[model samples]
Target: MPVASLNDIKAKVGADLGASPWIEVTQAHIDTFADVTGDRQFIHVDPDMAKQTPFGGTIAHGFLTLSLLSQMGAGVMMVPDTTKMVVNYGFDRVRFIAPVRSGKRVRGHFTLAAFEEKRPGQWQALHNVTVEIEGEDKPALTADWIGLIYV
Candidate 1:
């Protein structure tokens, strides 16, 4: 992660923050997510059943991919040097464009879309995020993620 002054961080608006390291989406990951979320959908937890589907095999849940943004963003985000805390303000929009098959790798590409001071010691940042699946022509997901930072 890059550490910069608030002004310097804000200066990154419209800049590409770069891509995060690739993370493999294994069947175990899918199963754990399914168990935790109680979303026992056959396509996510049952490989044999999923094999007959269009995806060919079990696929990671869309929310599983979306939830990865936290781990992914930690690798590429810019943080203010004086920041005291940060909070997820939620996404403005999210679209799951392609299925992420189990055992495939995915990474995040982030761009600082907007940054501004919302209060004397608080700021809001909007990041345009694309989660790309390795070797795939289309990205797995895209979202506009918001964060609130306090310094």
Candidate 2:
């Protein structure tokens, strides 16, 4: 975990938070995400059916890849010692730029885009997050993700 104070974060608002370790996007992972989200699209759940599609095989759900940000962010950042709680504020924008085919590896790279104090001991942060597919030129997705840190 990378620890930084409110002043430190504000000072480096546009700094790279760094990338997370690569993780495989398996068919099972996609299937479970689909089950949980009730988003059983053939391209995500049925390999045989998806093989005939443009992707040529099953791919991960965009939201599934996006959801990994929480886990990935953990590897890239730590809650500041002064903060007692943190919560997802919401996303300002999100775009799925590429498909993450099942069994492919993916990782997240983040930049701190914005930081502001909403009130005493409460701060708002926006991060520019990109999910990269291994060996691919284009990223799988990009988002302006926001979080609320309470101190």
lDDT of each structure? Answer: 0.95, 0.89
Q: TM-scores of the models, in the given order?
A: 0.98, 0.95
lDDT of 1 at 51: 98
lDDT per residue for candidate 1 within 110-142, as digits (tens), equals 999999989898899999999999999999999
Give the Cα error of residue 52 in candidate 2, in Å. 0.7
**RMSD (Å) of each candidate, 1 decimal:** 0.6, 1.1
Please count the clashing residue pairs in each candidate, in the order shown: 0, 0
Q: What C-alpha lDDT does candidate 2 achieve relative to the native structure?
A: 0.89
lDDT of predicted model 1 = 0.95
Stretches of candidate 1 above 4 Å error?
A: none
